[model samples]
Structures are given as C-alpha cells and as structure tokens.
Target: MQDPTATARPRKIIHIDMDAFYASVEQRDDPALRGRPVVVAWRGERSVVCAASYEARRFGVRSAMPAVRAERLCPQAVFVPPDFVRYKAVSRQVREIFLRHTELVEPLSLDEAYLDVTAPRSDLPTATAIAEAIRAQIRGETALTASAGVAPNKFLAKIASDWRKPDGLFVLRPHRVEAFLTPLPVERIPGVGKVMLSKLHAVGIRSVGELRQWPREELERLFGSFGGSLYRRARGIDERPVEPDQPVQSISSEDTFARDLPLHALDEAIARLAGKTWQATRRTERIGRTVVLKLKTAQFRTLTRSLTPDRPPASEEELRAIALALRDRVDLPADTLYRLVGVGVSGFRDREEAMTQPPLFE
Candidate 1:
C-alpha cells in the first residue's frame, strides 16, 4: 500500500475574511458613519457586541463583550443593530465571487470562508494572485473590504488571514512555514485556550519553539488527544482539507438576563428560547433528534443537558416540552442563580434518513 500524503501535491488554500463584517456594512450604507467608531449591537444591558470596527477596537471594544461595557470603552461609538437580511445578501455576492475561481469553497460563517484553489478555474498565476483578485472583487462589488490568507492548508490559511486586518493579504509559502510558526505563542494555536495555556506554562512551554521540544508521547500523556494535535501544530503540520458545504450540525438560541434568576425562574426563559430555536430549525430541511438545555451560573460556570428522543421533535410544542424537561436533569443546587439560558437542537439527519429509521416499536 502506498502512503497517500507522500505522493500528494501541495495544496493551495485561501482563507477570506470580511473585515468587521456587520459593522462595515453599517458604515458602507451610511456615509456619515465611515470614519468614526462603529459597534454593531443592540443597546441593552444584556446585549453583546456583534462586531466592532477598527476605530472601536482602538478603544478596546470587541465582539461578544457586553454592550454596556462597549459603551464605556467608546462613548462616541455609533451603535447599529444587526441586519442579517442585508448581510446575507452581501454574503451571497461574495460566495458568487468564490465560485468564479473554485468549486471547493467552505464557508465558516457569513463573513469568512476557505477556498481550495489548488486547481483553480481562474487564470490567476498563483494562489496569492487568486486571493488578491477575490479581495479586489469584494471591494469593487460590495463597497466593503476583506482580508485574505494564502497557504498550503486550512489551519495556516486561517491564521494568516488574520495576520493583517481590515484589508490585507498574507501568503505563507511552504518553505517559510517553520520559521513563521516557531516563535509564535502556543495560544496562537486554535485549540489552545486559557486552561491549555496554563498547563503549557506550568511545563515551561510558552512558544511553538518550546512546545516542539516535548516528545509526542509526553504531550499525549499530559493532554490526551489534544496533546497529539499540539504536537502536529507546533511543527506546522496541518493536512486537513477544506470541505465544502459542511452540513449545519446544530441551531440554538440563547439569552442573558439583566438579573440572575434562580433555577425555578428559568421555565419561561427556556420555553421562549426553545420556540426561537425551533423556528430557526424550520428553515433547514434536516430534522434534529437531540434537545439541549444550557445554563450559565452567576459565577459564569456553564452546564448543559441534552436528550435525544426516540423520534425527532415533530412540532414547536414538542421541542419546547423536551427543552423544559432537560432542565430537570441539571444537578446544580436549588439556590444556584443562573445568568444565561440556551436551547438548541442537534443530531440532524436528512428527512429521508430520519423517516427511514425503524420506529421504536414498529
């Protein structure tokens, strides 16, 4: 048997990301908001920032931060509520531009995507050139900006896309991959969160260079499956392909309350969230079998309970009932106060696949 990777050709992948997508669209449509700070979010105590323009970022505003905090960071920032209908229209335009170059386009979200242009349909001489063309087209057609990263694989491409912000392109040539990654902090790796960082620090591993010194066996012993991943990433060895049209794995709706509520007070919120999630799920053709209930305590600790029914939820009322029932499985103290609640549906299958499954008692 032959080794597949050994004979495989180097891939040319490009990651494209719209710069401050939601905020930029707001600025683009309204000329008066162009030069100033723009924060896209609802103005509410519980609202969170959806996107912040470069101007707002300079004031320390960031996406997902509470809206109230964002206001404190940039008092003069213009806040605009998100208009997903408009954003989706612009996203479709960007997707059309990607299809002009390659068929292997994987959209990560409304504002970012990965394109495998190893064998592009366009006559661009290099992957870098393709990225440039795409960026130019986005700017020309949408009156907005995008950043691009050209690399041999998805991981590097994603990292490189963010290397230069707003409107820039970075190409990571194969020859320079090692030198580029060597000095990077371990936290730069996608999965290295705060917990992982503390673990790496305790072991005196700070940079990719430091992490590279550890043997895979030791790393794996310390970190389990993730340790194996850290080992590969430290050496710039990512071979994952850009899979196009990845199916929607889940849909959810969540809310944060202005005041923390005891467990018993979550019933109304859970039902409301379940209704929102059910409506969102209706837009998809697949059916979901699992109902998930999530809660965040006042201390910010998160917990989730999920149930997969014998049959997928057949109506909004069924979804709401299952979501409410999942709350019963939460083992937190009765007095525990929760600041957030979420309802979600997952375990999706095509309508035919779901219908074909034998009934629990046929």
Candidate 2:
C-alpha cells in the first residue's frame, strides 16, 4: 500500500442511500409483497404516504403524498401501517456495518448516511472499494440493497449516489467534477428549492455554467446569504467536511393549510406547532432562549419574527403565547391571508451557560 499523506489527494467521501427503505423492509419481511406495489400508511383523510414501493411509484404514488391520493393513483396498491421499530433495528445493523469502515459516519436520516473513508480502518485501497464492501455487507446482513456514490466531496457524492439508484454504484472522480457539474441544471445544486429555482430562472441562469458566470458579490446581493453557497456549488466547490455529529440549531414545526386562512384563524395552528416544538426541545440538554414565529403569505413571501425573552419558556402554554403574539409583528394588511404558520425555539445555550446568566432584571 502507498502512503496516503505522502502527496496531495482529495478527500474521498461516500453517500449511501437505502432504496425505498421502509417499503423495501416490508417487502423483505413478507415474501408475498415482492414485485408488488405497496403503500405503507393508515386509512384516513390526514394519513399521508409513509413509503411506496417502486411499483407504486410507476403510478405516480410517492412518499409524503396524501394517502387518499395514493389510493386513487394505484387502487390495487397494498396498504400497510408503518413499523418503525423494525426499520430502526435494520438501520442500526446498517450503521454497525459503517462503523467497521470509518468513524466519520454522518447519518442524514434512518435511510441515508455520509461516510468519510479517506483513511479507512479496514485499509481499503480506495473509497470505491469501501463503498462496494459496505453495500455487500448491508445486503447480506439486512436482506436489503443500497445505492452508493463515491466522490471527492459531500455535495457531489450525494448527487452521484442518486445517479444510478436502487442497487447501483456511481463514482465522480476528482478530475471529472467540472465536466460533470457544468452542464447540469441549477436545481441539481443543493438548496435550490422551488423559490430559489424561480429566482435563478428569473435571473436568466438555468444551468450551473451560467450561474457560475456571475460575480460572487453580485450573486450575494441578489440572493442574500444563500448566494455565497450558490456561487461555490455551481463550480463543484464544497469545503464542508462530513461532520459525524452535526449540532442541533433549532426545534420547530409548521403546517400548510388546505385553504389559505386569515391571520386570526391561526390560533389553533400556532398552539399545535408550539406544543410540538416544546416537546421536541425536551429531548435536548441545550436550553433555548429565543422564540421564533414563521409565516408564509398567500403571495408566496416568507416572514419571520423572533423574540429572545429574558428567560426561556418554562411551559408549552408560554411558548404558544409567545408564538401567537408574534402575529402582531406582521406589518402587512389586516386582510393578508397566510398559507402556513410555524413556531420554534432557537438561540441554544448549554445548561452550564444558561445557569450562569444573570437575571434579566439585573
């Protein structure tokens, strides 16, 4: 084996994505479900698609779509309630397989993770080999298949992972980054959601090559803070390392209404989101002092208001009250209709720092 540190070599990152994770699990456990369209969800107006087999996807049924719509799309689809306990167990077994290759495992969700195996404990000759080995191990141990992408950075690896999915492997060599990324649509870049996509389109920048033509300062002026990220990603430049444990920034919840509602109609929605945020925050030792309210108007503009209280909220009611009062911060017309509302807790401080702070009255 040659020395890894003896010369300059780009970081080797791999993104592993389990194919139709929950659906695959269901099919694995039930022999009858194999090669059949399956939709895992409850039967109700509020029930959403938890997962759909590739067979169901052919009928335009997908995860997160309404269960009613999923049924209409594929009437013959087998519906099953989700079994998260089994899914998590399988996820744990897959994670154990990752720990054998490298400690730099960053789990994005139960179904996906990023591994930095630039230096592998297994002394693998290259990242591609490690990806293959892990995929083989997962299929043998878990009775499932995963797609693997090997690249020099996380962004490229994530894209490459999806290039040939459902038991596929793709590699983006360091020398081929520019050639591979330049011709792709701007939407292929991370953070280019619908709103950002519209913004890019309005600017007459449809491809990454066109997006990269703009000066950084101009891009920043046009898109605010996200513009910097846009500029770098256009050229396949991502400096972020695959951190094992990403820090928690906030806990929040929001709901999109079936019909746009006036601001006065949001009281119940605010309370629901606040209660969820408060419950989620309880899982963290870090204390949050700021209460944030997020709203989106029917005109498609997003507005945010936040208040850092003298003390963190002590109960769900207090959090709800703070979130509800934030509606007054909206300076729009009284008749302004809103489509979404959210409540959150942020500005985190560890218990040690929170305990030592002087009282607000002081």
Candidate 3:
C-alpha cells in the first residue's frame, strides 16, 4: 500500500571533518607536539582519552583508553588535559568558513559537518571544487587540516570523507556509487554495528555486494521494517536533506594524555579543563544548566558524572569546583591510573531579553 509518488530522489551531499580535531589543534598551536605521539587527556586513575594523534594511534592508543594502558602501549606518549574553549573558538571559525560556501549546512558534531553544495556561492562547476576551496580556506585561516567527502547522498558522502584523511579530499561521482559501495564491508553503513553484523553474517551477507544480491521481499522478511532501508542503502540511495541552524544541544571539552600523571594532580587538570569549557560557552554565547565530567581509566573503563545546578555557574572557579566534586565520586583502585578527562555544559538557554513575562501576582 505504498505510494509510488512519495519516493524521494537523491541529492548531492558533502561531509567535512577536521583531522584528529583536538589533537591536531594542539599540534598546530604547539610545534613541539607535531609528529609526536600526543594524547589529549589527563593522567590518573579515573580519566578517559578525548583525542589521540595519528602517531599515538599507531601504538594502539585510542580515544577512551586508560592513561595507564596507553602508556603500556606507547611508553613515550605525551598526555595533556583538554581545553574545550579553544576548540570551540576554532569550531566557530570553521562554521563561518562553511557559511561562505553554502547555506545548506548540517553540523554532525563540532569536528564534522555536511553541506549541500549543489547550488553554491561563486557558481562553482562541481561540488568537489567547492570542497577543495573550503579545505584550503580552513588551512589558511586556522592553520588546521580538514578532510572532505563529496557524493550523491549524505550516507555515501560521510563515508567518503574519512576515506582520505588528514587534509585530503575524496569525491564519489554518481556514476561510481555502486562500484564504490560494493566492495565495502556492511559495517560501513552507519547502523550496521556488532549486532547487525552478526545477523548479516548468519545469512552469508558479508559485504555490500552480498547485501545487494538479496531480493527485496527476502530482505523485508528478515529485517522487517529495516529491510527496505537496508536494501536502498545497499544501492547507495539516500534522501535526507541538509538542515541548517539546528539548535545547539551541548558544549564539551576533553583530552587524552600521552602519559599518566599521579592522582594528586587531578585538581589542577580539572581547573584547566574547566577554563576550556568556559571558553566554548562564551564562543557559542550559550549558558547551560547542567555540567558533565567524563573520565577513562588505564584499562579503558569509562565513567561520567553530571550535576544540574540551580543556576549555571558564572565563573571558572565554580566550574572547576563542580568538576572536581564529580571526580571525587568516581571509584578508582588505589593503584589505578587514568588516560583522559573531559568537562561539558549542556541544556542551553538564551541571554536575549524576553518580550513578555508572567505576572507575579497571578
């Protein structure tokens, strides 16, 4: 009983992501950190990794790894606590960079965003050119690197963006969509996580090429409501629109360290992280009612604590206190070490004056 007229046509989409966003920014600012294994997080028994430089990634040091474990893998790694405020300032600069290209922009996260540049400024002949120009501008303005993916739809475009990384560009022409997807693993499709992969494997569907071989009816019978979606995606069909001016949801800062520090330094680390979070709030000019602290241990265990303040803290000292208080709540073994720490503010409110107020007498 589906209406044929309701089917949507595909559109051009591009996804752009900063390369190793936080760590890259750190390296860009501090020349000494470049080409070194840099982990942007504090070292302790209750910390988590926020970002890992490519050099660090080579030693199996990944985001969310414990500071102790990361050190075990790469003993010489450098660990630094997060400074979110600076990252947010940089993100705002990146957003302004996007606006110059097209109005149809959808930010997936601070480090990544999607743009519908089918119709772009300056009458660029192709989306690829627009992507190139944007990347160049980012490098010029921020001294940072970004990767771009251009495709016929958002799904494909997002995957393509990560194909060539650390200041690279990849374009998937409409004609090459099927070829590009066929050899890719099913996991490349956004929602095909561990659970979905097992189901597909049980049915001998290991790759996009195999998934494409299933009859629509069989796929529908097996996956039920998700079958049609899977089938269409197998063929690179996506119809999502690029949305602009989505409301801000949260602001946060985190870092993964190269080495674990003693637990006693936790207070100093939290203070630095709090300052960073405050900067992000100022750049976005949004106040939040809730504050969150994230930690990852040396064994890669993750933990979070949050506090909803009666009113948002008006100063960095207040922010640090809330974060340090949350840190005390986490349970760490006497000898445990951490690899990362993060602070975030969410539940935003506007500063603008309201036109009407409720009557107090009522």
Candidate 4:
C-alpha cells in the first residue's frame, strides 16, 4: 500500500477573522445600532473599549482604550457591553460552516481561525474560493461580516486577512510575496513590537526591504535566534505546516458591560461567563486544570488572577466558585466600579485521562 501522507500536496492556508467582532455582533443584534459608531464596552471612570466599530475607529477609538477617552474622541459613539454568550454561539456557527468545506479547522480565537482547505469537500479549486464561501456563509447566517486572507502559508495568510477591512478578501499569490512585503514598515512583521522596532531603528533597518539587505550575521548578532526567523519572514519565506489538529492552548470568555457595575455585582457576570467557558471547553472536550478571572477597571487597567486546583473542576458550578474565589485577589476600593469581567480555563488535559482518574471526592 502507498503511504497516505506522502501523496499529500503542499497545503493552502487561509485565515478568517471577524470585522470588529464584539462591536459588529452588537450592531448585528440591534438594528438601531447599524451604521452607527459602536463601542463594545462599559461607560464610566474605569471602562475601556473591548471592540470598536469601523465608524468609531474613524475617530481613533480602539480596543483597550479608556471608555472616557473613546467618548471624547467620538462623542456620538454608542457603547454596548459585550454579549459573550451570543458571540460564542455565532463563533460555533462559523466553525460549523468551515467544517462543511474542510475538517482541518484550527480556531485561534472566537474571532479568528486558520483553515487548511487544500482538499475541500466542495469543488473549490483554490483557497481563496473557500475563504469567500466561508465569509459569505457567516454573513448570511449571522448577519455579521468577516474578512479573509489566502496564501501559501499561515504567516502570509494572516497578514493578508488584515490587509483589507470590514468585508474584504485578499489573496497573496506565492510569486508576489516579496513585492507585497517590501514596502511595508518593519513594525508590520510579526514579533516586531515597539521595543524591537526601536532596536531595529538603531541599526537603520526601518522597512522589510531594508531588513532584507542586512547581513545574516548582523541580524543574528542583534536579535539572536529571532533575527534568523525575522530574515526569513522579511523575504516572505515561512515553512511552518498548517497543522490540522493543533492542541487547544486555552479557553476564555469575557464581557464588557453597558455601564460600570459595582464590585459586588460581579458575581452575576462571572456566573454567566463561567457557564459560557464550560460550554467552550465542551467544544474542545479538554479538562482544564486552572481557572482564571480577568478584570478591566473603568480606568482601563487590566488585571488577571488564576488558581490551579488540586484537580480540574468537574462542573460549571465548581468553575464559578473557583473563579469567584480568584476574584477576591483584586484590590478594588469598596466603591470602585468595573467595566469588564472575564473567566477562562486553561492547562487542559486529555479527556480520556481525566475520566479514568478517581473522582474528586474519592
């Protein structure tokens, strides 16, 4: 018999990301918010934007910006708290749409994913077509829009997906990689953040094309192991495979309230999100060993607290209890208000292994 894996061709990878995911969901659910500047987050002293619609973005409102600052930037912007349960439901619907075309679906988050559709079920011959179909299906089914990018590899595909905004699709053909990357700023390269940009600027490397001219030895001297990787990416070379069964690294759920709620009312929000987190774990069917709580104050500062139980919680109630216990670690004033709350489960274990173990009480 022939080796089954040997005959497989190079994969065609596509990345799909929702446009202004939280804010878009809010707008889709409320017809009144359509075409308006929408910011999904609480409004108050400590609140920050969880997501901002394209309309809001025009005025410089952005995710993680203080709600007060966003309002100042776009006074007419409407603020809506995130409805995580609804978002998760829509995410699952999108995933199901992907499964209709290919089984090799790898979710990066609720709003983005990578799909290897080289061998799609439909007669779609190209990754671009697959992405288009997926985006269309998501829009038709949920009334929310998405953008997609198609390329020969994951790195380029992710970049392409962001090239256009709202309901756009971009395809980066293999031969055009270098031309596409050359003119962009060095900061556009993955892993090159503010600090890295300063370091690169010190060397007079300001753009992708400029980085390509640097001697390999010089890059290695400056960035160490990362320098070599950067050199390859600058030239649009990425050999990483499109892994179909990538392990689930983490599961989390967060919500932005319409108004900053008192600290005491957090229990209700946490309870609601804990159930959503449990449902997310069910989709992956992984047993998580740690529970975490995330909070963003109206002031825009973010905080997270986590706990590793002797063993993973077996029920949603148990998860909520653990998450609530972790919440006590936040040093909030008695009158302090919160704009957002989130719950997450991480450090997953195999389902079979988890089931075979003795019960918590036993």
Q: Candidate 1 residues 1-362, lDDT tens each?
A: 11212326989989999999999999999999998999999999889999999999999999999999999989999999999999999999999999999999999999999999999999989999899999999999999999999988788888999999869999998878888888999999998999999999999999998998899999999999999999888877777888998777899999999899999999999999999999999899898778889999999899999988778889999999988888888998899999999999987889888766543311
**Alpha-carbon lDDT of model 2:** 0.89
**Which digits, one per residue and each the tens of the lDDT, describe model 2 over residues 240-352?**
78899776778899987877899989999999999999999999989888889999998769999998777888899999998988877878888999988899888788887
Which has the greatest TM-score?
Answer: 1
Q: Between the candidate structures 1 and 3, which one is better when assessed by TM-score?
A: 1
lDDT for each candidate structure: 0.90, 0.89, 0.83, 0.85
TM-score for candidate 3, residues paired by index: 0.67
Give the poorly placed runs of model 3, Cα more than 4 Å off: 1-10, 216-226, 248-362
| Candidate 3 lDDT tens digits, 53-151 | 999999999887767788788889988789999999999999999999898989887899999887786577878888998999999999999999998
- The worst-scoring run of ten residues by lDDT in candidate 3 lies at 353-362
Clashing pairs in 2: none
- Which lDDT value does model 2 have at 254? 90
Q: Against the hidden reference, what TM-scores do the models get? A: 0.93, 0.84, 0.67, 0.71
Candidate 4 lDDT, 1-362, residue by residue in tens: 11112324756888999999988888877899999999999778667788999999999999989899999999999989888998899899988998899888888879998888887887887788888889999989988889999987788888999999779999988667778888989998889988899999998999899998987788999899999988888877777766666777689999988888877889999999999999899887678777889998888678889887766888999999988988888887878888889999877778876555543321
The segments of candidate 1 whose C-alpha lies over 4 angstroms from its true place after superposition are 1-7, 352-362
Specify the poorest-scoring 10-residue window by lDDT in model 2: 1-10
